[model samples]
Target chain A: MQRLDPLYPTCPIRNVIDRMSDKWSLLILSTLNQNGIMRYKELNSAIPDISQKMLSSTLKRLEADKLINRKMYPEIPPRVEYSLTNTGQKLMPAVGMMVDWALEYFDEITK
Target chain B: MQRLDPLYPTCPIRNVIDRMSDKWSLLILSTLNQNGIMRYKELNSAIPDISQKMLSSTLKRLEADKLINRKMYPEIPPRVEYSLTNTGQKLMPAVGMMVDWALEYFDEITK
Candidate 1:
């Protein structure tokens, strides 16, 4: 059996939280949740000000995490669409909780 | 008034979430919550496997954020105790929600 680290002690779960809570990751998930599946260009347009490199890297990371699905089409410009996997959908409630918390406490923190 | 970026667009909030969700930050917050206030050495001992450098850096960052209050008493030996500020206490509910979500969905994600 694997030894589980104590909650307050060092553990791998910390890394997981860090990855999931990344600015790009949360925003990407939020966009996908709202818009269903979207093409790469469309996604880029949807999230203004994100550099092309950062957006691509963020998408790649999410896909590697199995949270999002990337479908590619053999078209002239190589059409691609990104959507949430079952695991990604499962994360909705958790992300929603964060967003709600943020909205509720934004004033307190920002002040 | 400053121009607020769209939620879906790139914004500074992402950076904030990233910092708060860092493994060390969460675990430190959890420890502080359970222990009320703790000296630096006590905190280090409480969290096993955390390197001295990482622990020190994490504490500094939290203090800079105004989330954790660091009190240094004037004595023969330097003694410092860390506690939560009102802002930090307010963050409890948000952090709790994340922990609850992790616990509830751990099986699903890990499986």
Candidate 2:
């Protein structure tokens, strides 16, 4: 049997799973996956319903986790763009599986 | 592209994902998977950190979602036990993938 404590907050796996399971993280990752590299305004537009505060924080967390890359231009305007890092890109397949599962059971579960 | 809206509040897939992504649902589901059939008290003991309200509500949601089987037996006192439904069983592989990914990257992400 695996050693990590099942569902315990103290588990290291919980570090990733808990963060990933946050309200906006999966949505943000899914958005970035579909839209590719995008500027802050573009991402904000893409996910219009997210509060600016929430979006900014979620982006920071994803960046901190190294799941997404943030590029800052030294231009006077200081353009910032976001895209999935290699690790984040690789994570898409698993997210895709979850999405597929969601799609399959969406009606039954939600109804 | 999937017709489901990408990360929108109006989307049905969001209905499933958002609910599943709730703070306690994954933990509860994972516990059930690890422990097999368990009574309400057993579940409560297994995840000692979860509040009674949160655990009960999460269980109801999982049961309603058809991801868990809730069995009730009537004797002098009622006995209720919970286990994974077939659909929930199918979901384990995707969850396993995520757990694997988390295990591999936990150090980098958490550090």
Candidate 3:
């Protein structure tokens, strides 16, 4: 029972799984993987049905986790682009597998 | 853009990914896969740091989503056990991949 909390001192794997399983985190990573680097507005436009607030919040969280790099260009219109960091890039394979799984097995599961 | 929201009417895969990526759903399925059938209290005991409320809620969600089968026995103590459904079993490969990915990549990312 005590082993379940990945946050526990002994449970080193917990945090990693938690981050990967995060809802918007994986989606944001997938979007960036497919599109390369994208600006805030671009991402928002790319991911339909995501509220501005959710997008902003999700990006901030991803950036803080160091999974995505946020580059801000100082200009009249704030130019902020998000790309996967090296660490984030390493995760793309796993993320890609998940996306593939979704595409391959969704119909079977639903039907 | 419109293609990103898997939940949209046109997005058939949305619901499947949503269910698999659900926080507790994957974990419960993994636990069941490894241990076969486990009673409610046994599962609660097996997964450390999960609140009873969360465990109960997560189990109910998995059951409702048809990812797990719940069986209740008539006895002195309530005997409710959980196991993966066929749909749930089909998802194990993907879920196993995720767990493997976590174990393989966490050290790289965190370092």
Candidate 4:
């Protein structure tokens, strides 16, 4: 386990936690992890509540952060697919663990 | 790995993500995970920037969520120390992974 130096003004822990904790980003990453290589429409349908604007923006951010890769295929309509990068894949075990923990304590948390 | 049904509106994933994603809450949880039992002053000094109201409220929320246990000792000043519960301890590995990932990609993310 890494010792987080709390005194550091610009700690990477906070930056990474902030990104992972973003509800949409977390949900999106989890979704991508389960169903590999999702196009824009598939992603939108999978996460039904996300607005088109939000989905596009979030995807851009994730791609920028290198957590997900956006592949634009040269088709007549230009198909774009999104999937996790190696770094993103490495991060999912942690997410999976959190999901397990959440489900384990769901009743207590919701009560 | 839990299959998060994004279709499920009240998913535990979202609930957990929302709670964990709150910046102050994440920082506080990380601090408690690192420093074990901490009083209000210790916690305040550890995170440094959290306001009194925010710290008090965030701690209450975390305790209510069963993430941390707060013990108030009867003393001249009535000392209260905070530590993670079994569930919270269970969740720290995930947080630790996130910190590791963040540190690994700090320059890329910041650039």
Candidate 5:
């Protein structure tokens, strides 16, 4: 028997869902999964609809959650890149399933 | 390679995230997963904080997404029950993983 207590906001499942189930986060994950490491500009272009503000905020949240690794290269221009951590990679399978589920039921849901 | 185009608003992945990533849907899924079959009142009690309106709306959305099945018994008092469908059941593994991931990083995220 699993201890499912998502009734509380502090529940682990609730926390994960609150962070991972967003459109931008999923999109960001997909983008990172496909492109390997990406800079802010790369992520911005890859996800066309997200605003700069949204991207920065989401990236900060994802990093804070330890889902992604943000590396800052302090060069002349200070290049920064983002990629999924082991934990984030583990999350991809679930995301894949959700995408598959969505695709399978797209017609039914849309109609 | 995996057709990861969650960029569009109408995209299936986008649709799924928008619908399923909310706190209520996750709670509803957790409740249904544990209880197997539940009535509206059962779901309400299981998730203490959700408003009646939120529960009703989320249930309707989940059914529309073909994730859960809603069966209404038109008896003396008219009972209604909800449970995950095949698709919904398929989603549980991913949800389980998310919960596991969250628990692993709870301290880091909370602090």
Candidate 6:
């Protein structure tokens, strides 16, 4: 594969595309969108195939990107939950549309 | 990165996302979308940073996915052209919105 173009830094849309295209990000995003708030274990369980390491790192990346919220509570053992931020929530409809389009064309695409 | 799950075969949107996430495809599609029809050389020139091999393979993948059309004209030297198919065109407004969304969020996302 060609290395990322130097234009990456200057091109914002391409930057967004790169992030959204991270493979795991969309799956994790879609899961949170469908299930609302979830604990770390819940997110891990939602996608059984993802490795714990991948889940942890992707979660961090999403949190850093500010697409998802990672909230902590001070309780007996302490509680942490994950959910979409407002930006992440707003992004869902577009993602939903893309999912619809993908679903509609899946058979055609994979064959 | 984690190896893709066995679930990949069963997950259609994931598959769609995988294809779309190929790094070069979106850039190439956007180029074709804006410029209408492009010859191989034009496409190569349009994205100055891409290696020629990468462009050729991505074009083939797009054509195989039916997201773009590849046509050849017979002549002394022969000519080939590429453009989006109906499905690709349908997908681009979503991509455009994604670009807009990315542009809107770039400052926050990258820094």
Model 6, span B1-111: residue lDDT tens: 122236767677778787887678888999999999999999999888889999998898889889999999997699999999998988887777777777777777777
Q: Give DockQ per model, in order.
A: 0.25, 0.40, 0.29, 0.43, 0.42, 0.44
DockQ for model 6 equals: 0.44
Clashing pairs in 4: none
Which 10-residue span in candidate 1 chain A carries the lowest summed lDDT? A1-10
Per-residue lDDT over B62-89 for candidate 5, one digit per residue giving the tens place of the 0 to 100 score: 8877789999998989999999998889
* lDDT, model 2: 0.81
lDDT of 2 by residue, B58-102 (tens): 898788779999999986689999999988988887787887888
List candidate 2 segments past 4 Å from native.
A1-10, B1-10
**Candidate 3: misplaced stretches above 4 Å?**
A1-12, A108-111, B1-7, B74-78, B107-111
CA deviation > 4 Å runs, candidate 4: A1-10, B1-10
* Candidate 6 segments whose C-alpha is farther than 4 A from its true place: A1-5, A74-78, B1-5
Q: What is the lDDT of residue A25 in candidate 3?
A: 70
Angstrom error at residue B8, model 6: 4.8
Instruction: Write model 3 residue lDDT over B62-103, tens digit each, in one string.
Output: 777677899998988878889988867866776676667667
Per-residue lDDT tens digits for candidate 1, residues A32-76, read 998999999999998777889999999988787677899999999
Determine the TM-score of chain B of model 2: 0.86
lDDT of 5 by residue, A15-104 (tens): 666676666788898889989999999898887789899999999988877779999999989999999988788778777877777788
What is the two-chain DockQ of model 5?
Answer: 0.42
Candidates ranked by TM-score: 6, 2, 4, 5, 3, 1
lDDT of 4 at A26: 89
Error of 5 at A41 (Å): 0.8
lDDT of 4 by residue, B37-69 (tens): 899999998877788999998999889888899
C-alpha positional error of residue B11 in candidate 1 after TM-score superposition, expressed in Å: 5.7
Worst 10 residues of 2 chain A by lDDT: A1-10
**Of models 2 and 6, which has the larger DockQ?**
6
- Per-residue error for A22 in candidate 5, Å, reads 2.5
